[model samples]
Target: NQFKAMMDSANKYNVKVIVDVLPNHTAIDHTAVLPALDEAVGGHDKLYHANGFTPIKDYNDRYQCTTGEMGGLPDVNTENPDFQHYYMTYVNDLLSLGVRGFRYDTAKHIGLPSDPLDSLAARNNFWDVATGREEVKGLRLAVPADSLFIYGEVLQDKNVKESEYAEYMDLTASAYGHALRTVLDKADFNADSLLNWHHPVDGKHLVTWVESHDTYANEHESAGLTDEQIRMGWVFLTARQNGTPLFFSRPAGSTRENYWGNNRVGARGNDEFKHPEVVAVNKFRRSMSGQPETIATADNGAVIVVSRGNAGAAIINLSSEPRNINGVDTTLPDGDYTDAVYGSSFKVNSGKLSGQLDPLTSYLLYR
Candidate 1:
């Protein structure tokens, strides 16, 4: 029933749909494979990569190294032919289903080269190659080419280098860029002189975000900021330009658990389309913003806004209070622009414009 409902729900919308391919390991009880325990590991060859070690207490060994989180879940060895055969078949199933792309969860831990491939290597990296072109080519009988938009979940990098994950996928987002939460925590919320990390998106791939389904749902979640701060953050995350946008779904909160929904804004009290905070954010984002665009930064420090063809803009304030967006001395043509605080409204003027946004709120301008 659930699968049928999902398939039905998918057909109801014309937008492309995707599935998350978690590579690090299978869930503790996932039926994808059987216990490498008593069986000969048949019927699910790609699910296990024999490391040539018996007793095999766990699947993380030479062929498959675990991500250190111990449990019943066994990891797959991307380098193992047996595992490749298993996984490629799985990938083919989805492509045949007309699914648009894939979002790889924890792609870093599964590949054979755990040594951290360089930028050049990451770009040239290909799952199709590792699985063998012949295997991929043969799949033409089942899956079509140019059928997937693959990306990954790379949580953190202590070094803070952009180029590392930049070369690897078509679209990527970060849980690290929490402008929404940051602004909510601020007292003044000045976006001026704030260095917003939004520009590198349109021309290159970017997966930018604040929270996700996995984000904290307990009352203690949005630390350091106020409700208002988180609200503004949602304004930016949804409506910002470049890269694909992700909706955060936390089941246990005010209707809008994440940016994709309205737990933050409370549907502007009326719960209709125009009043709530996020509705304003959502409409603007949908109208504008596509991949392969770049951001415009006033300098490295004061203010930075990510934009894609004036479709959407995320203006952030890096300070404790409201910051003024100065370098943006230019005014946009008059039209209905979406405000993070206020819902959609026509831009009253075209002169150098400045508005006082809370610390955590990002003002989106959509024409």
Candidate 2:
């Protein structure tokens, strides 16, 4: 009943829920893990790896890395047909409860039996089975075609390519957040450099965030993103032409107590829900979702101007001092415009939008 109530509220608010699935390993005490361990010691019908090899440190060895125990959690031998059936049954039950999406946790660890290197082919190879399509004609009957959204926690790096998993689901752009944190700390942060940085995947297929659960709980203070900087990142993340942005809500007392423990809750605050600046920017992004982007970075990347194909322009000043950005190609009809965030009016002349950015502030301007 509570689940139904939650889903009803989400539907009322046009929110899509993505469930997290952990298919790599079972808890040390989980029923499946216990049985598997029992089978390993007595019977041959084991669900887990018996006599597990040396704990896998580097995940480069795709085969052993996926099958080996992680932190003593019993690694599920996903290659086994029996395990796949049991896993999908659990997933289908959730599907029947009206879930439409999934976020596969440690998806890269769910390896196919055929690939030795955890190649792109192997990494993306198990969706058919894992998604319940391997045995069924079209996933669960409750799942409608083209309605299921899935993403994975495939943390991207030089060794791990986020693009390889795009076909399955959007991969978290962890590096993108790190890059944003790095530049936001600079006294002369260049807006142009931000524009020129290589994105891991196409915007549509990337899940962009300023902070994730891991980062928020573990690295918030250490990451050096002040509250103001985090808010600025939120504005940019939401206003971008590509990617879906997720906002991280910092617990109220966590800031004061400096507690970064996982899944622990602090007092709730009304500020995140009622913040006017954040509310205004979300509206701006919602209204300008399909517009093309024209970017111009100047002042050695200190001031970056963006025109969203006549929909609007965003002027960002990353520096500590106030900055006046001029000669920005707005790509809009010459006319008067106002910043949606700050509510300041300005004039556009000859397609050039001129504006002043306050210290460490951004202007979300539009007609």
Candidate 3:
């Protein structure tokens, strides 16, 4: 019933739901978990990598790679077969709701199992949704394996290895891709070199972003990035390659409009969403979406560069002040073009061009 209700809401707004699966601990009120906590609880040891001390509510993500802490939600013992089965069953109902993809909230909290067993359990449950999660049980069904999609909330865990992640899904966890977030949030660190930290080409796929619900929730300072800054942040994400880059909720300047139902909660009157500038972002995304993985990268403001699958080529400026530093490298049909970020175009005659970029702006011109 709740799954149906959730799907109904998602359908209304074209959104997705990520059913939380706590493989380490269950809710404090969970009757099934009472016996485990009180009696001689057996199993679930591997699923719950408890420290020598009792577990706390929120696991610190800044350290101890591959671990996270949800708000007071008890971690589930992912290693326990019973818990796994229960999770699978829950997935069945969720799938029946016509769910498209998943956002594994607080992925690090999972008592990550050994090898493919844990990984397979986590993903198989998702695909087995059609048969009410019976793939792992008696009368296994040949569920359409590729139906369900999975994306993880890896958060700040940087050390989550790609090799380990690739075992489970194709588009996998962000390789601690929070570097983009760090650059956007940390004002002092918003320099050009920050782009170097983007980890898109890892063994698994990754789509980058500048902000999200996690960024805006608690830390007020981190929540609201400026319009220009947000656009600039997305310019890289929308234009770059890797995983299916899930964009923001609202467009630029639309945040003040509350497009995402910000006024719903009777909270301290906290209401706002991303602005409508995302329109431009979607335009860029639409143009580049699965478009042969063209790429451009620059470090330390040296150059703003790009390539259309090593075919089309481009180079722009990232410095605060423009300078005509020659030594052009491009594969464009030698001619002229315009810069998207700065607005004024350029000439690519003889495979050479010079241009200027406004502060915090970029350029994308190709053949």
How well does candidate 3 score on lDDT at residue 323? 46
Residue range 319-358, candidate 1, lDDT tens digits = 4455545434323544445564555232424533344545
TM-score of 2: 0.82
Residue pairs in candidate 2 whose N, alpha carbon or C atoms collide under 3 angstroms: 190-301, 190-302, 191-301, 203-243
User: For every model in order, what is the number of clashing pairs?
Assistant: 35, 4, 29
What TM-scores do the predictions have?
0.62, 0.82, 0.61
Model 3: per-residue Cα lDDT over 35-143, one tens digit each: 5543323443443434312334334432222232244444444444454455655565566786665566555444333322332133323223322334444433233
Q: Which runs in model 2 stand beyond 4 Å of their true positions?
A: 28-45, 50-54, 112-114, 117-125, 136-145, 161-163, 187-193, 196-200, 219-222, 256-270
Instruction: Select the stronger candidate by lDDT from 1 and 2.
Output: 2
- Model 3 alpha-carbon drift over 4 Å, by segment: 1-53, 56-71, 80-82, 115-134, 139-145, 156-162, 170-178, 181-204, 218-221, 248-277, 289-305, 309-331, 338-344, 353-367
Weakest 10 consecutive residues of candidate 1 by summed lDDT: 116-125
How high is the lDDT of residue 50 in model 1? 41
Which candidate, 1 or 2, would have the higher TM-score against the true structure? Answer: 2
